[model samples]
Target chain A: EPEVTQTPSHQVTQMGQEVILRCVPISNHLYFYWYRQILGQKVEFLVSFYNNEISEKSEIFDDQFSVERPDGSNFTLKIRSTKLEDSAMYFCASNAETQYFGPGTRLLVL
Target chain B: EDKVVQSPLSLVVHEGDTVTLNCSYEVTNFRSLLWYKQEKKAPTFLFMLTSSGIEKKSGRLSSILDKKELSSILNITATQTGDSAIYLCAVAGGGSQGNLIFGKGTKLSVKP
Candidate 1:
């Protein structure tokens, strides 16, 4: 079965540096989403993208965060300046009516 | 604030045992409730419920929605140790986004 794929299964970065998490959602899906799971916490939605633009976002998705589908098959999330709290497992998902998730990129900020 | 709550954070059962996991939610413009199973990786979809009273079944697992009580329950009968995992309940709000709000989940451990 086709599944969403994410790059850099585990990423370690310095505080205040920039990092980009990459995902390739299932082809033919129209909607994409980004979510994070803080250690020992529930997963929280960051943003949702549809039709080449952001359709919805949560409070946690602020100026420092941005998502873009630079081209077909690639969805990326960038953080301008990382913070310790930004450390979490970031999951990228796609929906063609039913949603499917990627294995996730575990981001660790030092 | 909209929230999803699951009960009995964790449980342990033996093979062939029957178990029920609970989920309750409060969200604006509720559309559908869904269940997923998570092991070590991302969650895998299980069932989606849109209306109350209709039961969705897949093999040994089944789920039902009770909109009147704003809750749902997942039942796993004749459970196997492989059934051990975290069960997540999420709600899809009515709109184009279909952005889901998920509960923390119930962790189940099935022993031999």
Candidate 2:
């Protein structure tokens, strides 16, 4: 079965630095989404992307966060000035009908 | 605001036991409810319930949705140690955006 794939399984970044988490969604998927789960917390929605634009975003997805579908398969989330609270497991998902999730990228902001 | 809540945050069962996980939600324009299993990594899709009173099953796992009650239930029969994982419930609402609102999840531990 085809699955969503993300790069940099784990990342460690200094506070105030920028980090880019990358994902390659399933080739035929039309909708893409980003969600984060703080340690011991529920998964929280961040943003959804479709047609090269943001369709929806949560409060956590503030000015510091941006998503781009720079290529056909590559979807990337960029966070500027990362904060300690930004550390979490970030998941990327794609769907035509039911959403499928990637293994996730663990971001550690120190 | 859209919200999903799961009950019995944690459960413990012995091998060959049966377990039921519950989920309830309050959301606008509810579209579908989904169940996922998380084992130290990403969540793997288990089932999706779009209509009420209809059950979806796979192997020893089955799930049913009750739109009238705004809830869903996931049942695992003859559970094994491999079944120990966090079960997450998520709801998708009708909109252009396809993001899912998730519940805190129910952790299940099956011992030998």
Best by DockQ: 2
Assign candidate 2 its CAPRI class: high
- Looking at candidate 2 chain B, the ten consecutive residues that score lowest on lDDT are B92-101
Tens digits of per-residue lDDT, candidate 1, B33-63, equal: 9899989879889999999999999999999
How much is the lDDT of residue B13 in candidate 1?
93
User: Interface RMSD value for candidate 1, one decimal?
Assistant: 1.3
Q: How large is the C-alpha RMSD of every model relative to the true structure?
A: 1.0, 0.7
Top TM-score prediction, candidate number: 2
Candidate 2 wrongly placed segments (more than 4 Å): none
Give the Å error, residue B98, model 1: 1.0
Residue B14, model 2: lDDT of 99
> In model 1, where do residues sit more than 4 Å from their true spots?
B94-96
